[model samples]
Target chain A: MTTFETSVPAIEPTGSLSDSVKIHGLLAEFETPGDILKAAEQVRQAGYRWWDCCTPFPVHGLDRAMGIKPTILPIMVFFAGLTGLIAAFVLQAFTNSSGMSVWAMVWVTGYPYLISGKPLLSIPAFIPVIFELTILFAALTSVFGMLTMNGLPRLNHPLLGNDRFRRATDDRFYIVIEARDPKFFRTRTEAFLESLGAVAVEEVQD
Target chain B: MSSIRADQVGGRIVDNTTEVPGTRAPLVLNMTTFGQVTAQVAKVSEAGRAPLAWYVAFAGSLGLLGLLGVCVLYLIFTGVGVWGLNTPVAWAYDITNFVFWVGIGHAGTLISAILFLFRQKWRTGINRFAEAMTIFAVMCAGIFPGIHVGRVWVVYWLFPLPNQMEMWPQFRSPLLWDVFAVGTYFTVSLLFWYTGLIPDLATLRDRAKGRLQQVAYGLFALGWRGSNRHWHRYERAYLLLAALSTPLVLSVHSVVSFDFAVSQLPGWHTTIFPPYFVAGAIFSGFAMVVTLAVPAREMFGLKNLITLRHLDNMNKVILVTGSMVGYAYSMEFFIAWYSGALYEKFAFVNRAFGQYWWAYLLMVSCNVITPQLFWFKAIRTSIPLMFFLSLVVNVGMWFERFVIIVSSLANDFLPSSWEFFTPTWVDIGTMAGAFGLFFTLFLLFCRFLPMIAMAEVKMVMPAANAHHDEDGHHHGTPAPATGGPS
Candidate 1:
């Protein structure tokens, strides 16, 4: 596969923009990694930084093309789990000790079975319930945190409406040169994408 | 299937190479795929006798279940006296079968919830079937205790409610604790299992041939759209439920153990029972998984996903749990001897060399010695051996319950009360019926439902872009293309 090269011009968006800005950027599809890398390098050489690549499966070097970094879900999950443990402990202590007053009063008044010297408030026995609650909370927090951070429950997306995108479920690859990218100008980016060996390029509207 | 290398791609491949066209490999089949259902059904029926064999098995299980139904009706119409549940053996087959079926149900949670929490991917293939097993087994188990109390109509008395019968189920009673534990376990397991099934059900719904099929699968599918948003929330909710379920798995079994351990019965009272019973529950549960999975995998043409690797993993678990159970058995003996209580010593000794020596030997052989063969790679991987050993473990575990319930009660504190507990036709018949109920439901489940979790299998496929190593984000390859013939 020969690498595709393109040039891109910078265009910063204002709080608002002209209706003439309606010229939507398009996506380029590729069938191989060499094609993507060569196209990315050519686009860089062309001074355009407005393109993205999508595939049915994540390509190993796709991040380099996009300049993305690792996420912090693991660290967030760690702290969330830690918080769950602390919450469980505090909840148990407050509920068992201070909240036992009514139970203590009722028992002392009406039902007193004298056994040996086991205390009425046994913290040790309550540890099992507390441990279970801690794991329960930690698991819930981490999972929910993952969902929220990932932006879930979105029933629809503009991407889903595209017929060509159907292959995303089975086998296909695509890269969109968004107009919002810093070095995006429709004509220049389109020219750059053409040089990058995109089989077909079609504009995606907002 | 042909393998395409990056070198074969036109020019230097792009940064993310696309799919090589016309190379979708056929799905693999094995023990984990169809086992008793598809695989065995595939083999025995291959001589063109499978339909006949299925008919025979179905008819046999149905007849046995019918007999069991008769036995149950007889017991309810007459009394508990239909079984040989005399004074010393009051617990008899009802309690034994109760514990037996509950133990059988344990594998479902172990395979699904526990394994999922551990991030074991192989669980996807087997968890569906195991969860179904858990539900049916629990159904069988729940029946025994419900009718064990003579007035079967008032079994609701165990429920904690304010009513005309103005009495509360004693919170202190282990039996009440059992009610809560079993009920909670069943509900939670059912929810977890069904939640996992929603997406798969949608797959089935879309492919159903008729309206009734559509409605049945559609209702259960809950309108799953396979959208990123639904998946995101579904994943989160599933994880939360799984987390909730993990402790419940341990607590539920521990509570069941307490049913015996909390009792003043000399052999029953032991601190080790909780973990011991839990391990044994898992042991027998895994055994059942293997017994069912091996055949299901083969029959269903799911060998690739449910691969030999999965079978090896399950075998290893069985060996570990089997050993743990063996250790518990020894510990009980040591504690009995060290305590120097005559009753305890007698309970321990009589268990090994007494009149019920056959039961003791069966327990040791099945739960302890039988699983040891798994130390050999051949035995672990060999389908036939695993199936036979699973039966051994099942029979062994049943005897373990028998030895515990009968031996301890038949010759307890008073010698005059000693009597050999014998199971009458009703006792044997009801047990057969429970098996019938279990198989009948299982056979029906297999006929419907995606026997394999199609979406989950696709997720784990090497080509499915489920994981992004750089960003730690898994948009997951779009939902897999469905309706492929096996």
Candidate 2:
């Protein structure tokens, strides 16, 4: 079979890379959000770009402590909502007022009917659908934009496999600094995390 | 069995206003650590077997849901004539049920969106449950309109789409506005609910012992690592959604009102309909929230989180909204008389003394008179009385829609075509079946997911406000309280 012929050569390259299991990151567990809040400020000052703190809930001032920039999501959502509003108006205006025909499978012509002597292009009447579309677009963007920015729906994360670090979602707070960060040296960073009073620090495997 | 879980409060834990002699009670009772919050909520979902009551309730709900399924099939196969719809009363039970269920969905959004904007930290306890109720109630509401169309397969025609018929949905029509409004509402509510669930799902995913449980929870959890970067954007998105939803909550019911108000029918053609309908929606929605919450918190041993304060607060909302609804009812009659229009006067007068007088009487007595009982602190806090009153309010609300829709349609201007409307067995069964669908979804949500928003709850506790530098916890000794539930 063609499958058997291609498989023999592909295994050789993967076998060479198997022995050196590269480190994904290091996790430093904190007993309290307060503890992590203090350490995050230190880490932020140290200029480690590839690090993130983890908590069970949204911690007040932790973003500032970590020097995280305020998200631009609201600005984007506003524009997305605006697009919905304009699109609704255009769609309604063209279909109900203009003698426009658009092709989808076939040319579908706009058919406007006189009902209760109401005008065909009534903006007042069209407002509800416009308003609803605005909301629909903004809401969809908010959820999807948040997910996209977070790089979520990731099937695996290195720290999820770590036992003690699993408490990040339960009660404990964690700070993980990736090994790929420029300032990251295994010993020095571990010592720095320990000195900042991490209750426990563990290396995470990729 | 009492207000406090007596066994859990070992003097160190503050259970209530009366728990400790010198201190005021905390919002969360008999708890000192974040771990305790996680454990309390997780235990409910992680239980090997649900309590006896769960099985009993689920069986009853599932049975009714089956009734709904059968009724839908029968209606589709046999046609829409299975219901008691006559020529004049064509919009009788179906439209009434649609409005009733849609109105009941309002309270959930009000709590989740409006309360969040107001910075009501106490909403943390019950917002998730209320939002779940909103989604399910909307689902139930959606069914009525979809089936009432008679031709189930052609429901897609409601949307503005390119078709061989060469037609577009009339955007100018309030009915078409309703399709978009309700559809958008369902989509937004689902997104908001799912957004709230991700972190909690991660919590469930982490704690799951069985392989199947782990995989199922993990997949939905989307491999959430509780990263603060994610939470930062997540929180921003939540705020944006809440802000978007606030006006949306108001708009949905208002558009529903437009469905009637845009018409020229005497009783239905009123400018006051939007606010009146929205108030009634909140009234009935709050009542339904209590109707579900009282049993749910008790059944799941979640009394400490969803405490008497939460119930007391919800009853307060019911009382305010109920009084508003009563005022609106009286105002309608006044406006009718003030206008001096013959048909309007007859519509209001006939609504009171017509064939549907019994329905009007039940609405007034239950909605107007029952919520007045919540004025007493003892009554508001009393579990059994509030529970009973909530059910009455729900019944009163359902009848309110029935009277409004049927009475007006029954005695229209073309009096020769008018007729007294009555529900057939199918009509009654389908309405009851909607409740079955609602409860079936809710019971499953409670069983499989974190019924309480544990993450949000922990955000509100006093411990979250601690500043390590100021508190001198800087050297960071492992606080014994920070460990997992002991």
Candidate 3:
């Protein structure tokens, strides 16, 4: 019976830094994947750890050039799946197996009943529920793990302000070295990117 | 020209002009550059409006959806008695429809998950389309079971939540397993589908001209910037999810089969039901995909992207799975006669020659006999013939469920309860309306979203700009040595 409206504040590009808007990074556009890969290798060798290459699709070997390490998501999923399997077994056993309990008087939480002369705690019957829960937990872990690792749901990023940077998802590739990086200098980074055959270099404001 | 020996062609270095023996057809036809792949797919979504045929189809689907809504409301007001369910045949059309729709949902996961694990690149072209179909088919499947409970408002009792009565769901019941299996299947499927759609949504967001489109597509894109670091982790997560989904696909249908196999009924109790049902599910699911893709590719002018090769591959799958289903049918009869139980023997015999003989004959003709035509290359390659055969498979699959449910239940072991079962108008109306719901959702998807996976199709193209050598000299060119081996 209620509705809520959440709107993202519009990003305005003024080409100047103000209190509310500071230089977030320098974005360089490359016309080809090879050019971007060459530039990324240079950036990595130049010891810029906070830089990344963006492409329309996953450029093979670009991860090696950018020096990104493998993720630990598979381990997280495995543990989450194990937790689900154990939890399902415990839940079923507690709910279906009758045992004496100490309350004000002796009572039983589980009212066990027999069907087709099977045992009260049937592991065979419990297997399906366990399997389903395992998958459910593992799947949930992977999706949420991905989102958290990617720092998503922030709803806003400074790179989105630049119109030319939008081509990162379309037909162009980019290399952006954040302003927060230790080795980054606006003019020097722009010059380096240009030396690596960047067609355009622009500043991203926060 | 008279007789060029193998040694004459540079000794095992064959010329480019000569055709190689037993070489497979190219997965992607009309090899184009990366930018062209983007432009071709993006143009469909970027077009200001859909074509006239799309509008016409959408309108027709909406009309059927409205009819479905009416039938559902009427069914809710009146009870399950409005269906043709009687003493012996209580699970007639509703259960049949539920099983049929659920079976139809299996092919999407098979293509997206199983084929991906095997490194089949051809699946990239049509995986998105099939996955969407799976979601919609599951939606239709969920409806039948939800409404069949009669007291729809109390359906939450299916879950094992704490209540004032202090009673829990019977953990021993396969029906309860159905709840969790299908529930998890739907959730994971939706997550997988949305995850795959994110990059494409980002592409749509960047290309959007209007402010509203930008905000909507941007919200779903979740600020995806195509960073190499993100893609690295994203690819790992995608593969892990695919591995998880592969087993989920087998488990979901196996649990559905458990709904029957676990029971003590004469015809329903069998060990073969799990694999038989899974094979049938993929068979029907592929049929539904072909039924949809043929018209969609033609109408959207996507012949180059979804080529004849894709259709041929799908037909091959249908051929294999259809044969598996046929084998299961014969094995069921042989086992029934070999069991030495009078009830089981009569169950098999009555299915083919008893009161519901027509349903059995139709199921056999449509499912087992019709699909064997795909063995001919000419029949498989012809567009119109494949489309018609796909529809026939659909009809046959529906009757297969009908025969399994109705024929078994129409005559029990007790002679006192033997009777005939028939459907009421409401049964027929509701079944037709489910199609209305399916097509309505599918048409909306076609109109609004990118039907084909654009980013994926680009990855498979010849000119996607990958570095093949350490020197980085080799880029976006086919390797010369690739023709030497398989």
Candidate 4:
């Protein structure tokens, strides 16, 4: 209550855990994937939503830890492929049949173009290009959509600022209980993380 | 049901049988390193001196290719009258070779694209070489058509343009379609093959000892990094290309088939050509794959990568397609009998029991009969037998085309127009030269290119099987499962 006490950076009482609590903006390292997963599960169970997992390689069930759903890439690729099929079919048919003025000349020339009594606009004939277009479109969608969804071409990140995060390219795994999570209290979250087998717990600063 | 042990100890079936003196339970090498991996692969070589044989075969092929060059020169100087190609039979050997080469290219795409889509993992071992064969074979196939037009200089006329001449390639013509189909196929297959090579090129670049090697590989690699993001994009692109290629493969051959089928030529005017040609294409392609792979496995020490298992799988494909081709043969005969059309009946009869009956029988024996042996596992698994069978398949496939082209053209409805067409020295030389061209390029590709995809192979290692193996390990834990904080 005194002016000197306010200037002295407000020392907290030892009895009150909340008043004595300290928050560190850094993620703790995990010695094994199991340790990281345990922490992630505890955080998830406690109803903390804002969290992420980073690893050297894609770790199985990491998506579950981060509460991430399956990607819409397959759907996007399917549609893109469908578009390709349509484009190829239409283009080939038009060019082969109606688009060219050669039909009129052939009719007049009387060159006897008949073969096995098959019609001009054959479905079997067009199948090849149609199939080709489907693949072309789907593949393009997969490549482009994957890039766009990942928010790639990013030259910098908050994780890039940390030296410890560099080990994400090696044998390290990380589970960050984000500040935005509702259950992320400064002291309680750290204590909870320590209890869930995290080797060290620190807050990640943005 | 087929247990060797007669007695049991406790609850477990146990045998107190002595190990056979000669058979020490077949010591399977625990492949732990790349060097050991190479050693295991080397052991798969049925012939230790095969690499030396490869050098001799390559040298011989190169010589033949050179002889083909001389023949082409002779033809260029002497004009169209060098040998045969008189009047109605003008297209003979040139067209046959063209069709043959184009058919050869089909196997590459069928092996690479369709097989890739089906998740046939065995394809990974042979697809690379098959693709290389496709490209080279196509190159050989393309040359005949280019030069056969007489004025090889004016081949650009195939390309549609609003030029000073103000003419267009006949859009209605199947030949024009052949140009489009073949051109598109070659371009797309080239891109598909190159895209797959980029990552492998990067691997080679890292391993290169010389400055030139590094620069060459680096250029081809396009600065590929194994970043997961890059891999994600690359894999998607590759899948798309493979998808594109499946249709492209079919179209290329169908277009080639149309060259014969769309016309009112007696033997060629059938609706079954597309499927028939596709089956034949795959049949021959598998044969070529076997031909190249059997030798390549022995020479490049890729037996493990291109295992007996892979060969067995390819042999199965060959058998299925070969049967389809054989079915086509039977159908052609049935259609001839069923249609009651004099020309169709004559064409079919002429093809089988006609003047070129030997050619027809050769085709049947090679394409139809030999592939049937694949039904037996022992025959399919035998390296020497499969090699011989592959060669037979290739020869039969060639004869099939020969019978189709020569027999039909040699004796058509009008006897005056029908002439027995024989290949000239030039024709024989050029075809032989194309083999030379294929081998020269292939030999270089083998020496230079990272023939095996090391990165891809590495990705398939036990370490990469972590997820799948976990399910396996739940039943058998040799060590305390490392499933906790270390």
Which candidate wins on DockQ? Answer: 2
Better of 2 and 4 by lDDT: 2
Each candidate: chain B TM-score: 0.86, 0.93, 0.92, 0.87
Model 2 chain B worst lDDT window (10 residues): B477-486
Q: What is the TM-score of chain B in candidate 2?
A: 0.93
Every candidate's DockQ is 0.05, 0.41, 0.33, 0.08
How much lDDT does candidate 3 score?
0.83
Q: What CAPRI grade goes to candidate 2?
A: acceptable
TM-score of 2: 0.93
lDDT for each candidate structure = 0.66, 0.87, 0.83, 0.66
lDDT digits (tens) for residues B408-471 of candidate 2:
9999998798898878889989988988999999999999999999899988766665462253
Superpose all Cα atoms of candidate 4 onto the true structure and report the RMSD in Å to 1 decimal: 10.5
Writing each residue's lDDT as its tens digit, candidate 4 over B1-486 gives 111211112223222122445522111113333333323432322223436766787788889888878877787777767756766566777887888888888888887899889976557667777888888888888988888887776779886543444344444567877776787677777777776676566555544556787677667765543333345445556676777688778878878888889878778998999989988998888888888888887877665567676777789889999999989999989988999999989988888888899999999999889999999988888889999999898888778887887787788778777777777788777877888888888876776675655444443333322243234332111222121211
Winner on lDDT between 1 and 3 is 3
Candidate with best lDDT: 2
Docking quality band of candidate 1, CAPRI definitions? incorrect
User: What's the distance in Å from true for residue A32, model 1?
Assistant: 12
In candidate 3, list every pair of residues with a backbone clash. none
Predicted model with the maximum TM-score: 2
Clashing pairs in 2: none
* lDDT score, candidate 1: 0.66
Docking quality level of the chain pair in candidate 4: incorrect
lDDT of 3 by residue, B388-452 (tens): 99999999999998988888888888989987888998999899999999999998888778888
